[model samples]
Target: MAKKVSDIGGGRSQAVHRALKRAILDQALPPGSKLPEDSIGERLGVSRTLVREALVRLSQEGLVELRPNKGAVVSHPSLEEGRNLYLTRIALERLVVETLSGSLTQEQIDTLSTHIAAEEAARTEHAASIRLAGEFHTLLAQMTGNASLIRYVNELVARSSLILALYGRPHSSECAVSEHRELLDKLIAGKTDEAVALMTHHLDSITTRALLPRKDSLADALHAYAVAEGLA
Candidate 1:
């Protein structure tokens, strides 16, 4: 048995929330998996109240569904929903590149470069690579400094991860890394049109891999994540 998570005395809810979110995003907690409050709390050594708080946050983020009598479960987005998400993401990311085109300071450019380097380093790690790929876009959104855009992009990127888990096939993180580098170059050159086009194409390629649609354990699954989060 995985040992119970400890060391989270007062911040247990946040820790639970992050661990659950990562599990869902990593597909360790697959779509439709039951998130029994007791099991999660017991596994993580948190209380039901903390578990509920985490679930409520995940629910609000569109990563978890709260069924009145059915408790909470990982969200299972339909094909149509997945398609819409990608379309919206494409549009939003276009805006991101467009907004960021000539505006990046040297320090910001270095930050992006460093992140892509990290992505390169994590190429062998499937879950980490995928999460980093999604986060790259959210990082861009944050740089845009548009509060509303940041919120929307963060939500969409997270849901997109869930969508990929449902419908995506085996992927190559190298390709995404290369594309990110090229996109970064375009942004550095202040080529608004070219940058937007590259951003659009990059996102479109990712969507194409998944938008087709096809296709869990609970405690045993959350155990690893609990340990990772130091909850176990």
Candidate 2:
């Protein structure tokens, strides 16, 4: 029988790691935010030791930086690092799509369509769109059926989304809805080469456009940037 994740100390470590990682990935703790170890430890109900270890794991993932005296700070990937992260994500996801092409079944396609539908609904409902778009990629990995690849893709997608949080443009929340559904349709229809090409194009669009300015709120914490861009 498989072990329940909540039954052991190791599981507690993983839970802390996951909780902290998600907070960082979602930018709930935004870039450059100092990780207050004691606060997190209190929240997670773990020792400072566990929280510190979790921070170290996050640092290894490039999501947090361990400063000599400043402790761990959520990473703010520079523009160059942002682009490189996106490029690497493109490469990895391209490979995943290529591998899944001509192999996915009708049921798999249907499942993905359902996930995409939820994403669209989330967009329509005005929920956090960037979070929804990231979920879309995560759903794709889940549907792809290769555990190892899914693990790597999850890491890449998470960190790539972090980069986007740092430097992505206004429409970053606006994922290509029609294109996503169409890619699944194409794959199910046995258009492997076309699916790969379309995957490449989709990633390119995200990477290229995120290089531009955003439609940030005038009242956003980044109001200075919004004003500088004449968006206010």
Candidate 1: minimum summed lDDT over ten consecutive residues — where?
208-217
By lDDT, the best candidate is: 1
lDDT of 1 by residue, 110-203 (tens): 9999999999998887777888888889999999999999999999989888877677656645588999999999999999999998888888
Output the TM-score of candidate 1.
Answer: 0.81
Candidate 1 regions with alpha-carbon error over 4 angstroms: 1-12, 213-232
- Residue pairs with backbone atoms closer than 3 Å in model 1 (clashes): 4-232, 5-231, 5-232
Every candidate's lDDT: 0.85, 0.74
Candidate 2 residue-wise lDDT, 1-232, digit = tens: 2222232468788888989887876678898999988788776677778789889988877888999987889988766666676677777787777777778877777778887787677654322455566677777777777897787777667677787776776655556677788888887786878987887888777766655434445476577578899987
Candidate 2 local Cα displacement, residue 39, angstroms: 1.1
Model 2 sits at a Cα RMSD from the real structure of 6.3
The local lDDT score (0 to 100) that residue 111 gets in candidate 2 is: 76
